[model samples]
Target chain A: MHDIGVRETIRFLGLTFNIETLKMTWLAMGIVILIACLATRNLKVVPQGWQNFVEMIILWLHDQIDAMMGRRGRMLAPFIVGLFMFLLASNLIGLVPLMASPTNDLNTTLGLALLVVVMVHCLGLYFKGGHYIAHFFQPTPVFVVINMIEEIAKPITLAFRLFGNILAGEILIIVLLKLMPIWMPIPSVCWLAFSIFISCVQAVIFTMLSMAYLANAVKEDHAE
Target chain B: MIVLIEINATILAQILNFLILVVLLRAVAYKPVARLLQQRSDKIKGDLDKAEADRKAAEQTLEQYKVQLADAHKKAQDIVDKANVTARQEHDAAVAETRKEIERMKATAQAEIENERNRAFDEMKSQIVSLSLAAAGKVVMKNIDTKENDKLVNDFISKLDKNMFADLR
Candidate 1:
């Protein structure tokens, strides 16, 4: 597990980059794109194979998001669906030999969580105008500090929740590899199975939480 | 752990990566798949609606046939009833006409019998009067003439016909 905390980084246009994480992200993106293209290739009224499978995922996300946000949620369906697909891909990619999850890195998860938080704020403002801002100081002005901290904690928790789980799973696998060297196969398999389940669960959790936040932002508040 | 969670420019690149991914995936994946699902949902809904409409149409046609069948049944009954009424009227008229013809024939036969009986009575009276006149003439040839005898016979025959007709009445 010596290389657990070590990173493969590079310089491109004078900016430092995490090459390992970026490359994994690109791979996940490519997989997402390829799956989408293959599913959409035939474009039949009666769907079969990949078309049916992909449509099921897309529509499931559509329904889940639409339920949270109503018709307005339809606009966010593509992003939410794409995010889920990407996260699922990123999470599962770590299972491959010589591969790591992009989500296992802090940068990728933090970036995603920040994006969700920022989107929530932007959508809140767009939908509720001044009320979105005023809601922070709700019930009394004294609550603003708590509310602000809560808002800040949202992205942090979101990022760490995903990053922590995936990184721990990867670390444990490495530890098992280091500790159990020859007879590591059984522990590896067991952990791999657990990690796969955890991967799916984490992806769902992140997507659902993001959807809730977005819905909370865009939905109209009832006037008393 | 600090190194593992360190912040870097890679976050910016990753953000850019996710954004590009979202855009590209939306363009290539979500939109087309969503549209296909929508189309399939629409097709299913349309087929269901068409089936419902067809069922309703079939029910409507069945109702119409039922009404038409009822009308035909009523019409056939009316024809039978009308035929019965016409047949009764024709039968009654035929009976009345037959009764009238029978009555007329009886009256004609009575008249003809009365005429023949009157003529026979007149002839008998004439023969009786002639015989009596002859006897009287025989007696009177010694005493009267033939002209008196014929007049006597004719007057007697007329009287006999009038007497016989009165008695019969």
Candidate 2:
């Protein structure tokens, strides 16, 4: 099996760099950006071809954001859509020959989770003010410790859930390939299809969780 | 065949890449497409409003035309009715005037015929007196006195009753 971590680092100017994940991440970013540019270029009032496809994807993402985040979804739609696109591209890249999925690395998923957690807290403070921190001690003071622990667990679980699933899928595919190397391609093919399904699901889950976090953070606190 | 788990600089690089992608995609794609959609919807709304206004104006004009046509029809009917009444009155007056003229002409003709018959009766009476006087003169012959005879005849005629002439006729 390939390394579970982003193991390939290139030393440059006395500094170490994790080159494999970085390169793959950059490749994913480039492909997404290129498609975005092509889709937006020469946009007609009447859309056709690539524009139609891109618009459909954007409209679906918008609907997801609206459903999950309610009235406040409009402000965050672009970021959420970008997150989904990036995750989807990164996850699917592993299906191609000689490419590793960047999301398989703990560092990458953790970084994304940290970003979400920080944004959530910041938005909570902005929208709810003191009530944001006061939610932990609701009903009685005894629940404060539990609430704090739950809050800390949020990022860890978010990161590990996505990382574990994608990494396991890739590992399973590798093992299946090795087990049936010649003449019998059914097992490997089936595993590949399953891996693809997992990748798509993980990307959707990450995006949905992120939106949910945002919605929870920014919502108005109604005292009961 | 081995796997390593570590935290390193790749996380920061990935974060940076993700942020850049978000900004780039937002600039090149999301904003423009959204603006185009809004503009198209606004244009469609304006066109619909204009079409509605045009339809309303056409309906108003048609209504005015209908009213005018109705008025013209009523006016024409009134004129025909007035002409018929005037013609009937004129015919009635002409007939009454012709009847009055015929009555007046008949009265004038009857008066003229009565005057002519009276004049003819007077002429016949004068002729009879002259002829009777001549016959009396011839019967008396050379011995007869004309003046005396004439006086006698005049006296006799004067004393005679007019009713005796009616018996003679």
Candidate number with greatest lDDT: 1
RMSD over all Cα atoms, model 2: 6.9
Can you tell me which runs of candidate 2 are displaced by over 4 Å? A1-6, A13-15, A222-224, B1-3, B47-62, B79-169
User: All models: lDDT?
Assistant: 0.88, 0.81
lDDT, residue A103, candidate 2: 90
Give the Å shift of residue A90 in candidate 2.
Answer: 1.1
Q: Backbone collision count in every prediction? A: 2, 0
True contacts kept of 2: 0.69
In the order shown, the candidates' DockQ scores are 0.39, 0.36
TM-score of each: 0.74, 0.74
DockQ leader:
1
| Residue-wise C-alpha lDDT for candidate 1, range B48-130, written one tens digit per residue | 99999999999999999999999999999999999999999999999999999999999999999989888877876786677
TM-score of chain B of each: 0.54, 0.54
